[model samples]
Target: MISLEHANRIVGATLEKGKALGLKPLTVAVLDAGGDLVAFARSDHSSAMRPQIAMGKAGGALALGVSSRTVGDMAADRPSFIASLGPISRHGVIPAAGGVLITDGNGTLLGAVGVTGDTSDNDESCALAGIESAGLKAKN
Candidate 1:
């Protein structure tokens, strides 16, 4: 279960990591196992669209059981199918990096964390750091 507290911890850690790395302002979103938003945070100077992008990444991770980076790669290979997915999934399918699935010690899926604002690799690193800080596993 992804409680609000857990979700917030992930967001805080992600934001702090980005700050420490001197990355751009970030927006983070956490989603529960049921694919519902549980927590979110946006740093100063971040774009207004960041929150939406974060949510899309989180939703995409939960829906596909993989990181949004993987989704982006897959989409690149299947543009037409991926294009149709946006509307079919109600815009939940964002093919980008920075989204990662969260799992417990036993590797049970708990939820996901999504980050935006920096380069895709940096954003993913932040999300992974957050998940690890929460003493959870990051899958995909």
Candidate 2:
């Protein structure tokens, strides 16, 4: 489980990282292992769909047990399969690089963090930064 405190830290650090990199306005979502939203935030200028996109990224990672980057790769290799997941998944599966799974020191799954509103790589960097800032490990 991800405590609200850590979830908030992840959101803050993710946004801070985006700002530091001079990236576009970002939206972030943190989800627990069971794919439940723990915390979420969207920058003022973020697009309307950002909230759903962020949650999808995080939820997809949690559901698939892999980073969203890997999901993107899978989409490339198996488009139909990845696309099929969308209809069944509650948050939908977003095949992007912004979603990352979080773990503890001993490799216990904790939660996932997702970021958006910038390039996929940049979004992923922010997610990684946020996880690190919280002293958690990213299963990237």
Candidate 3:
């Protein structure tokens, strides 16, 4: 479980890392193991779709039990299969980076963090930084 405090910390740290890296304004969404939003934040000047994109990234990861980067790979390998999931999934599926599963030290699934508003690689970096700042482990 991701407490509200942890979720907030992750959001803050994610945005801070994005700023530090000179990336674009970022939107972050933290989701519990059940794929429910725990915390979310969108920086000023972020596009309107950022919230949905962030949620989709995290929700897609949770739904598949893998990082969104892996989801992207899967999408690349099986485009039709990945596209078929969009309509059936509650949060939709975003096959891109910046969505990472969170785990405890014992490797227990806790939650996930999703980030958007920059390049996929940069967003993923911010997500990892946020998870680490919260003293949480990122499921590889």
Query: lDDT (CA) for every model shown?
Result: 0.88, 0.93, 0.95
- On residues 1-140, what C-alpha lDDT tens digit does candidate 1 reach at each position? 88788888899999999989999999999998888788998888888789888988888888888999999998999978876777766337888899999998888899988898999899999999999888888985
Q: Which window of ten consecutive residues has the lowest lDDT sum in model 2?
A: 38-47
List the lowest-lDDT window of 10 residues for candidate 3: 85-94
Can you write out model 3's per-residue Cα lDDT over 24-137, one digit (the tens) per residue? Answer: 999999999998899999999998899999999999999999999999999999999999998999788899999999998999999999999999999999999999999999
Regions more than 4 Å wrong, model 3? none
For model 2, how does the per-residue alpha-carbon lDDT over 18-134 read when each residue is reduced to its tens digit? Answer: 999999999999999988888999999787999999989998998899999999999999999999999899899999999999998889999999899999999999999999999
Q: What is the lDDT of residue 47 in candidate 3?
A: 84
Please tell me which model should have the higher lDDT, number 2 or number 3: 3
- Badly placed stretches (over 4 Å) of model 2 are none
* Candidate 1, backbone clash total: 0
In model 1, the Cα lDDT at residue 136 comes to 87
Q: Judge candidate 3 at residue 44 and give its lDDT.
A: 97
Two-way lDDT contest, 1 vs 2, winner = 2
Clashing pairs in 1: none
Query: TM-score rank, highest first?
Result: 3, 2, 1
